[model samples]
Target: MLMTTNEPQSILDRSGMTNAEAGALYRLLTWLSPSFPVGAFAYSSGIEWAVEAGDISDAVSLRGWLAALLADGSGFCDGVFLAQAHRAAETGDDGVLREIAELAAAYVPSRERQLETTTQGRAFIEIARAAWSYDGLDLLIASCGGTIVYPVAVGIVSAAHGIPLAPTLHAFLHALASNWISAGSRLVPLGQTDSQRVLASLEPVVAATAGRALLATLDDLGSATFRADLSSLRHETQYTRLFRS
Candidate 1:
């Protein structure tokens, strides 16, 4: 007797679906999508300068820079703002949200990094409102008088999507690290396998950073001043470059 083949079903198909689950999945995919209009592809966040300066000319150096960045600087700052924004949105407190937005805007040290956060933020808000119709998100967008910062947008969208703040913050940092690794792989001529290794090396850092972010307050948004700020400013006048910043 010949047995008939029974192909396994996808997890999505196997687990019975709910509207909430579908909505959450949709929001996660949309937020993480490269085409989400966050403009993440355009900015290199000063890694370009590190490459040009011979400081990050190899995978090892690039990984070190990225690790310091995520653990100590913009990554940590953004996570704090994201958590604050989430709380403000949850409470329907526009005043708190506005304050958080202003703080995030002022947190960046260089012109390029400043433009990077706010420009992509404003763009993300527009795309988010267009793509996902959430009432709270609409309210938040309408409240923004000018450019919104990236962390603000992340918080609002994460709340709208029903994702917890900690995991959302973790994913944001992970994506940032990965983006830098990809840029480094090209700029430094690192092999794809080496790039993967660099990213894998960041898993523990990401977890520790997220844990730290959870306990972080608004007052804890300090960064490593010299390298981070100087690199970003120097990138502005770099005679030749592959990245915008």
Candidate 2:
């Protein structure tokens, strides 16, 4: 469990991470990387529609949009699922894992959103098992009934691989924000430099999101970014589009 702010730091805090932690960190980087073959590039998670609707047209607006997503929208909700899945996996509680996986799958606001998350989730699991096979990976797979959502897929694998929750949660949210920024760069036609700038500006939002998720339970899972969800819902019938969601 996470410690409260009033408590002192654990003596286990070290000046340098151990070899095992170093390895786990490397795995997280690889798994969440844009080139991970999860086909994450094929979906924009509704950023395509937002750009078309002028909700995001420049670096400034894109930054603000992503900040909200990472804080009060699907980003935070996914982080909560990820953290919960991680805990369930760590404790070998398939019952809670099943509930989380199903809830995450059903939580999408649109068909495309559901398609975006579950398709990538399925691919994520298949690839991870192929390259980094672990015995415990199937625990959540069985629980989700083959319809795993992306963040929960990642959380389960991360825990089974011995990755600690804090860094894994941080990396997951960072990758999420990064992917949305990538979609915005293409849709808004922003310069690569500006895209990097927008991502850099979101570091704090990502950090705070992961921190809250680390302490959150299922009761805290919800989204308030109505526009973002509406964009996703309306994208289904959009006249023109370049993304799958």
TM-score of each: 0.89, 0.91
Clashes of 1: 0
Give me the candidate number with maximum lDDT. 2
Candidate 1 residue lDDT tens string, 27-110: 766676665667788788898888888889887888889888888888878888888887777777888788888878887888
Q: Whole-model lDDT, candidate 1?
A: 0.80
Query: Model 2: what TM-score?
Result: 0.91
* Tens digit of per-residue lDDT, candidate 2, span 26-124: 789999999899988989988998999898989999999999999999999999999998898889888888888889889889999899998988898
What does the lDDT read for residue 210 in candidate 2?
A: 89
Q: After superposition, how far is residue 13 of candidate 1 from its true place, in Å?
A: 8.2
To one decimal, what is the Cα RMSD in angstroms of model 1 from the true structure?
4.1
Please give the range of 10 consecutive residues that has the lowest summed lDDT in model 2. Answer: 6-15
RMSD of 2: 7.7
